[model samples]
Target: MSDLIDDPREGANEPEFTVSEISTAVKRTIEGTFDHVRIRGEVGRVVHARSGHLYFDIKDDRSVLGCTAWKGQVARLSVMPEEGMEIIATGRLTTFPNQSKYQMNVQDVAVAGEGALMAMLEKRKKKLAAEGLFDPARKQQIPFLPEVIGVITSPTGAVIRDILHRLRDRFPRKVLIWPVAVQGERCAPEVTRAIDGFNAFTAGGALPRPDLIIVARGGGSIEDLWGFNEESVARAAAASGIPLISAVGHETDTTLIDFASDLRAPTPTAAAELAVPVRAELLARLEEIESRRISAMRTALNYRGEKLRDLSRALPRVDALTAGAQQRLDLAAARLPGALTARVDRGRAALSEASGALRPSLLARTINSARERSEDRGKRLAPALERSSAAAQGDLARITKRFDTLSLAPQIDRRNDALAQLMRRFKQATEVAHSQRARKLDALDRLRLTLGYKATLERGFAVVRSAKGEVLTSTKLAKAHAVLDIEFADGTLSIGAKKTARPSASVSKKGTQGSLF
Candidate 1:
């Protein structure tokens, strides 16, 4: 007013400002004060623009500030902005002086220390470990023939495909899929849920319980694979009664689930390998055992044949000893003294009668009569004596021959008897061999029961199955796990169930229950 010029309707002349003038003055003031500065902060709200500009917010727990990088400046950045990463951003401060708005035009960026993220990971790992999630005792052994294998992974990812391919190639067993999110914010919860679902199914008896469960994912950054290391997922794996095989990330990377699970496989293929025995190897082993059995039986038979040969060779020696004794008996019979005495007695009797009739005529008569009688007796006795001697000689010879024959016969009889005895002994030996064979067979049967997969099936202990025909080994596969098939001695049953506490009797096998056929 002091220097005012008179205007129409008593108005005073005043200085007017243009938009460009105000804007330029504010912009110059902001450029002068801040020039260039660098601030360290956690990156947040980072956005990449379609036109190559980058917009972001830098934050601490208590505060947030906006940041931007133009296309030209963005090209110069050496590192990408990641959420929760502490970084140092070099930029000049600029102001929208009209509205008094302020932001940093980021020029360069570098990583700051990652103390907070490390602290969080360490805390979680400790918490989970303290809760026994990594205890070795919590692990379960994987089934040899996993009728149904459960897999938890990103459904559409390469991890799932890899697992499927490996499983098919190795085992070709049935798989029960519990599709889960394997990465991102929701991954931890989904993995935990899948583990829980598997547990419930194993415990309850609806879906056949997976004999083994596989939790697998492809390789990724620590943050991307963090879900497997989550306390929730680890605890769920620990709690699952069914065996779990963890396959997460690369071979070098280990997660919390690896400690919590029954086994840790470097890749999905390794998981499948751990879950099943190699079929070819098993078949080879069976063939080897059969060959060994056949070899053993052949060896047994050969040994028995050798023993029989030894027995056969000993038979003739016993017969020879018997023949010599019989020869001595025959010789004593041929030289008898009794026949000599009988001939001498007749001559002595005739001499005594001649002496008793000593008168000459009487003597002559006696002598004549004695002589005639003697002649008559001699004539009769001559033929008789000759016949007797001949008979005695013949009898002696016959007796000698018979004695020799008898001795030999006895020897032969003894040999024959020994042979019979040997036969009996052989029979006994064969019986012993048979008894040993029976014992071996029984032992083999017991071993078969212990080692054979079907032994348990025969023992009235049937594997429960799901409606989909997968064997249920545990309760983790069902919401309310139900027994589908009841395998019996004769056949299988499609059985419905009720809650009964009484246990069923185990299957008794006819072959093993003291029955030899």
Candidate 2:
């Protein structure tokens, strides 16, 4: 009885415990008290860990509470945590024994209200806008008529059915459906992949590539349609090689993809309408154009025919034009003989008058006197002619002897020998020049063989080039997960470079060694 009384006060006072023991007790109590609780606060200091876990702080105007979502729970989260976003996090509160603090292990997270969702959306819009995804220059022009239209949406949803029905009503088109989750964690990645896949197809292949893509989904709350606002989906839309039409929701519903797309449709049906023109309207336009062309051609032909008829009426007859000329020729021919006879008679009369003016007796006397004078002059010139001939002969003989004394044959021979010597020297110089040029050409050929890129390829060395055809001599210019082309002597090989988890230490070491070498 004495021991029980002594120990009652002592046992109560001696109930002290170690730090770990007290922490364990507190952890259990807090975890049990806050099990399956929902907390509403604005998110702050969000951190996505490399392990796929999320760490964040949830705070009101009064105080803050640390929160954590494991990788598995994060996958199920409807809204990813962002700073200053009001959200409702559902989980259990637990204590960290090591740090002596308590936090919530979040099982799921969602936007608290419409206001919070809009605020988050606006924030994302600003971020994407800064990256130039919403630039007008980035937008493509929608094709007037697409041969194949790629549709990205849930196949079972009303959005696809509406789009197809509208297309059938207006103009039937070939549609390739890429069914994807429209409102979940899978939505963003599936849509992004669909856009990229459509672009990757080779044009004019067996499965013809789509000329236009329509990403459609029905109207929903901001949270339900949040996938369209994902950065990946927006960027994929912006970078699409094929023109894209964004029909994410109703006219009032807008998403980030709309800004990046080539055209934004108010509804799925409207997107189809924008894709192609009505067949009946097109046929009517073609018929009108054909009628106008036929009318113009007929008018032109009629004008030409009328002009030809007028020209024929204005033309003169060929026989009538030549009759006057023929008459003039006949008159000239008839008077030609008479005119010639008159001219001959006039010439004979003039000649007879001139003959009658002279006398034959006077002419005979003058001739007799002229003959006697000619005989006297001949006798006087004979002796002088003989003397002049003798002197000329002597001068000719002396000139002949002088020519024989100074002969040109030997001088001609000497000149020919000098010319031959010069010809031989010229030949030697030409041969020397030809040999020098040949040696220089041989040296140039050797230099080309040693310095040319083809020679390097022949030595089993390859040139690495990027997709843009720029030569890549170092890793700095090479992009991770990018394709590269290697040029060899035989052919070219295409390959992809994977990003290394850690940079190699040997890179720097080799660079130093290369510098030394």
Candidate 3:
């Protein structure tokens, strides 16, 4: 057995170990070799976990190295790692015995160089451009004079002081400062949140909403000004309800936020100048306008006064125009009595001539001659009257006999038949009118059913109403915390209204379509 076992030293050279033991040995070797390192590579899939740990992969053309930045170390990183960004990560290598894996525990990270920074920026720019956030139509017009201007920057930095001083020189306005980190890992998130916070205020609340926003920073390199190029900052700026002014770096330093903003300023001071008009210039303009207005009014008054004088000279005197009519009236009054006397004398002469022709003695002689002739005629007519009376009695007796021969029963029967036929026709017309009225009533009933609201309710549609029962047809009218009742065909649902957010251009279009439905 001793010979078969061989030398213990020989056996020790070829060691037999359990899985854990082998893993531990390998971990020590790797960790000891790479105790501290500074590696440069392009970042791959970066995952920020809820536990505040960041896990990512750093890869060159040949191979990839797994990396991790713990919560504390991640907070200290100068540059937040993004996928496809080439960065230099400085940390110590470590191993996980459980999974038999080794990784770099990144303690610090920085952009590899200006070329990498520019590459990353160009990639982000393309993504935002595809979303149309940089469209000219989406940009807002900055107010000439904002009531409350919100400024986002590092409060202690010279940038803020410059902006404030410039604004003071131009026009004094109410400024609300939102202090944020101007660079480093905290910059992007802080800037994004500040923009959202400013927009979240109620328009007329105790803390009034800003009418315009200015995001300013002093001149710096691309890396120092990387926060403005962040996607979150760009989207936030694009989604701002208030018009935004981006002044990130010097005139040549353009960032993603500049495209999304309503206006871009070369410098922080220039941004302030754009926010308001110069006080002296505005006052001078108003004074000029007032002088012009007064001059115009004076000219108008002079023209009107001259016109009134010309009109008065052109008008004829009322008394002079009526003199001829007054004279004619006086002449007619002078001839009135003589004209009446001549007309009365003519009437009296005509009556005297008629009276002479009808004298009483001449009328009495004519009446005596006519009476004698009438008495002779009456004596001759009495004999003829007695002869005619006998013939008339005979004719009357013949006519009475003919009337008795004719029967009246047949005529009475014919009249009764005609009356029955007329009654039957009248009854038919009454029945026809009743049928027509009934048909019209039925048609009217069908029309009423078709036009009723019940028909519309049967369709798959609902009406949303507020607690006060007012219909909510617009998202703007839906207030936070208000109870909304959705009335369906079968039932109704009541829910609390959700707080509305600033919608992007695409989201706004979708919302408009939904409201129409």
User: What 10-residue stretch in candidate 1 is worst by lDDT?
Assistant: 508-517
lDDT for every model? 0.78, 0.90, 0.89
TM-score per prediction, in order, is 0.41, 0.59, 0.59
Better of 1 and 2 by TM-score: 2
Which candidate order results from sorting by lDDT in descending order? 2, 3, 1
lDDT of 3 by residue, 82-131 (tens): 89999999998988887878899999998899999898889889989999
lDDT of 1 by residue, 1-517 (tens): 8569654664446767788787787778877888889898888887998999999989888988788889988765655576667888898888665566778888888656546445545666787888777777766777779888899887788777777777676668888888887876568888999888887774346678777889989887776776676677888888888888999988988788888888999987778788887777888999999999999999999999999999998778765877888787777566556667777898899989878767688767777887887788777977888888988998899888878755477678899999999999999999999999999999999998889757776776666677787767654552244556655556777655443334334634542221101
RMSD after CA superposition, every candidate: 36.7, 29.6, 28.6
**Pairs with steric clashes in candidate 3:** none
| For model 3, the run of ten residues with the poorest summed lDDT | 508-517
Q: Scored by Cα lDDT, where does model 2 land?
A: 0.90
Q: Give me the displacement of residue 382 in model 3, in angstroms.
A: 53
Each candidate's number of clashing pairs is 21, 0, 0
What's model 2's lDDT at 106? 96
